[model samples]
Target: MRLERAVDDFVVQLASERGLSANTAKAYRSDLDALAAFAGGRGAHDTSDLDLELLRDWLWQDSRSGLAKSTIARRSAAARGLTAWLAREGHTTADAGARLRAPKADQHLPRVLTRSQVDGILDSLAALAATGDPVAVRDVALIELLYASALRVGELVGLDLGSLDRSRLTVRVTGKGSKDRVVPFGVPALRAIDEYLATARPKLAARNSAEETTAIFLGARGKRINSRTVYQLVASLLADLPGTGPAGPHALRHTAATHLLDGGADLRAVQELLGHASLGTTQLYTHVSAARLKDTYRVAHPRA
Candidate 1:
């Protein structure tokens, strides 16, 4: 079988059978496409031509080109998944990537905001919301829920009017793998959302001439907000803040998780709240909390 066709089939299986998210499937497809191009350059365009050596060489090339270890590791995993699928489905006689290995990605703690920093951000947004601008009010609600529920940007934008349970102060979000989980938010988030719905959402919804949208968060066009728009909103808010990592929506997620841990929230409970499939993924926030404590101790301790 042709390598390209094999990759296409593998990606389809990832989505259809494995229930991987579209973004994940797309990422695998991208990495495999690059591998296919590299193999084609080396006169190995068929599944039969793939070998363990070729897979290793592909990773080596990426390393030589200065790609981050994490990216190279992801590529290696993608290659392995493709080769394994090919072998299982009889496209290849054996798994070429079964023996493939890549450097372990460096583990850097996710960026987390200090409580004071988060408060400053929310205070600024609340002040802007007080101006009675519809978009400004929506921004307040958006950030509040982001920090409150620790929602992924995709999940946040995907929220519908029916997703909120105002009486319970919870939201029903479809998380990764299309799994549904109800997560609770604080009263602050509830108030912000209530205000947005009462004052801003109607004005924004009126701008849409198309079929009415059920989306809880509306863009300026009165349609469901896109992830890029949310990213832009967050980036602009965090641009002037003192932080080292990405200024995207996930920073708020990291902040929410770390703050929860610092305040003594149980790790297992946080795992469920963030909708992480693995508790190990949620444990990264513990390291962030510890790092912050060390910083605090170092700065305040009288003895070095």
Candidate 2:
């Protein structure tokens, strides 16, 4: 069987059998396509020609070209999965990439903001809210709840009016793995949301097509806000902050989780709040929390 056919099968397998989201399945397809192209370059145009040595060479080329270790590891996993599928389908006699070793990815701790830092960012948003532009209220609310709930940008933008329970202070979120969890937001987020609802959302909803009006957040054009718009909004906000590093919606999520842990929230409880399935996934916040502790001690201990 051709690599293209195998990739089509794998994508279907990911969507139907493995229960992957459409975007995730698309990413796997892309990775497999890249792997197939690399295999073709190495004279392994088909499953029969693909072997461990050829796969390693492909990974080597990617590493030498400055691709991240995590990316190369993911490509190797894609190859291993494809070759295993080929063997199971009897398209190949054996899985060639099954024994291939992948490089270890760096596990650096995520950046988190201090309480004062978070306050400053939100204060800046509040200043923008004072613009009385109505949309400014919505942007402030968007950033507030994103950090308050630690939601992925998809979940934040995908939010519908029906998904929020103001009485319960929880919002129903569909997270990764297609799992739904009710996440709680703090009073600050609630205040921001109230301002948006009272002033901004109504104004935006008025101009939008009735058919496209269910979303909680609206763009300047009276439609659902695109993910890229949200990304640029967050990037613009963070660009003025003190830290010079990667900043997006996920930075707020990271900041929220670390702050929750620093405030002495239980690890499992924080995981549940973040909708993380694994406690290990939530454990990274500990590194952030610990760094804060060390910084405080170093400043105040006076133990020269």
Top candidate by TM-score: 1
Lowest lDDT sum, 10 consecutive residues, model 2, at 237-246
Q: How well is each residue in 1-304 modelled by candidate 1, as lDDT tens digits?
A: 9989988988998899878888988899999999999999999989999999999999999999999999999999999998898889888899989999999999998888888989999999989889999999999999999999999999999999999999999999999998999999999999999999999999999999876999999999999999999999999988998879989999999999999999999999999999999999998999999999999999999994
Candidate 2 Cα deviation (angstroms), residue 276: 2.0
Q: TM-score, each model?
A: 0.98, 0.94
Q: What value does the lDDT take at residue 145 in candidate 1?
A: 99
Q: Model 1, poorest ten-residue lDDT window?
A: 13-22
- Give model 2's TM-score versus the native structure: 0.94
lDDT of 2 by residue, 1-304 (tens): 6777788888898688767766778778988898888777766666788888888888898899999998888888878888888888898998898898878988777767677888887898899889888778889999899989999998998899999999888899888778889999988888889889889988887777665677899998789998899999988877867764468888889999998888889999999998887898899899878877898999999892
In candidate 1, stretches whose alpha carbon ends up further than 4 angstroms from where it belongs are none
Regions more than 4 Å wrong, model 2 = none
